[model samples]
Target: MNVTVFGATGAIGSLTVAELLARGHTVTAYARNPAKVPASWAERVRVVIAEISDVQAIDSAVAGAEVVVSALGPSMDRTATGLPLVDGTRHILAAMATHGVTRYIGHGTPSVLDPEETPTIQTRLIGLMGRTLLPRAYAELLGMTDLVTSSAARWTIVRFTAPKNTPRQRHLRVGFYGTTRIGFAVGRADIAAFTAAQVDDDTYVGRAPAISH
Candidate 1:
């Protein structure tokens, strides 16, 4: 499979690229600074340097990908206010549509999913904090979700709880918020594994599944 990963320098994005390569899939790591990509991966994957906001650059990068995985998130810089995630996603969808690529797998927080699943007190509190403290980011994430849900391509949004740099358990609790009892945190490697696995999975297409543990 030919995979193009946006925000490839990010924690989870880098892991996803490594996972894809480990599974014998060709990968294109796209980021603003190619230098950020791990030196070890240089020989294994192709590197494309470009900003996600550049639609033409995105279109060219996504041209022949069999699957596109995005690990983009709100900028750590507080002054940044534009909807990069939403805008980047729109470009990705448009490019995919133009290139005939259907599979897309992206990551998000559990706050984006419904809390109707008899969520524990911890889950509710986390969701509340995310909405209250990062309202703008949450709004952008919602906009991104709207764009994805309305797109013509096959998409999967993997919602997760707090991610830590822990070892992969290879075990996950997966389902909608109301149906899946997620843990407080999950390993970044596990999240990458799940994202990579979705490339061949149709069960989660068009749905956002909250995963943890």
Candidate 2:
């Protein structure tokens, strides 16, 4: 499989690249900062250095991809401005469509609701905090949700909250909010594992499944 990962310099995205390599898949990682990418990976995977807003760079990165995974997300900043992720996502989806790529695995939070989800205390609080505290960033995330779900691709938004730097966890609770009880926190490693696994797994395609330990 030829996998291209956006936001590859991010914590979870880096792990996803490693997991994909471990599972015998070729990887193309798009990194904004060349310094953040490991020198060891230079011989192992293709690295494209470009900002998310670089349209031609993004198009070239996804040109020959079979699966695309995005760990791209807005920082949890209350003062976040200019929906960068939303615009970047729009370009990414357009590139995928032009390149004839179908599978897309992206990241999001529980605040981006699923049709099957029923409001829970945890969910309600998440929504409230997003709107009250991080309004701009929250809106950007929702904008990303709208684009991903509406695109012509087999997409999966791996949703979670409070990711920790803990080791990978097993038996993750993966499902919608109402039916499945999920915790507020999960290991970043676990999230990466699940995100990488999505390249070959269609169980959650066209659905956003919140995963937690």
C-alpha root-mean-square deviation, each candidate: 2.2, 1.2
Tell me model 1's lDDT, rounded to 2 decimals: 0.83
Local accuracy of candidate 2 as per-residue lDDT tens digits, 131-154: 898888888889998999998989
TM-score of each: 0.91, 0.96
Model 2: CA > 4 A from native: none
| Candidate 2 residue-wise lDDT at 135 | 86
Using TM-score as the measure, the top candidate is: 2
Q: Measured by TM-score, how close is model 1 to the native structure?
A: 0.91
Candidate 1: segments with Cα more than 4 A from true spot: 114-124
- Clashes found in each candidate (C-alpha, N, C closer than 3 A): 1, 0
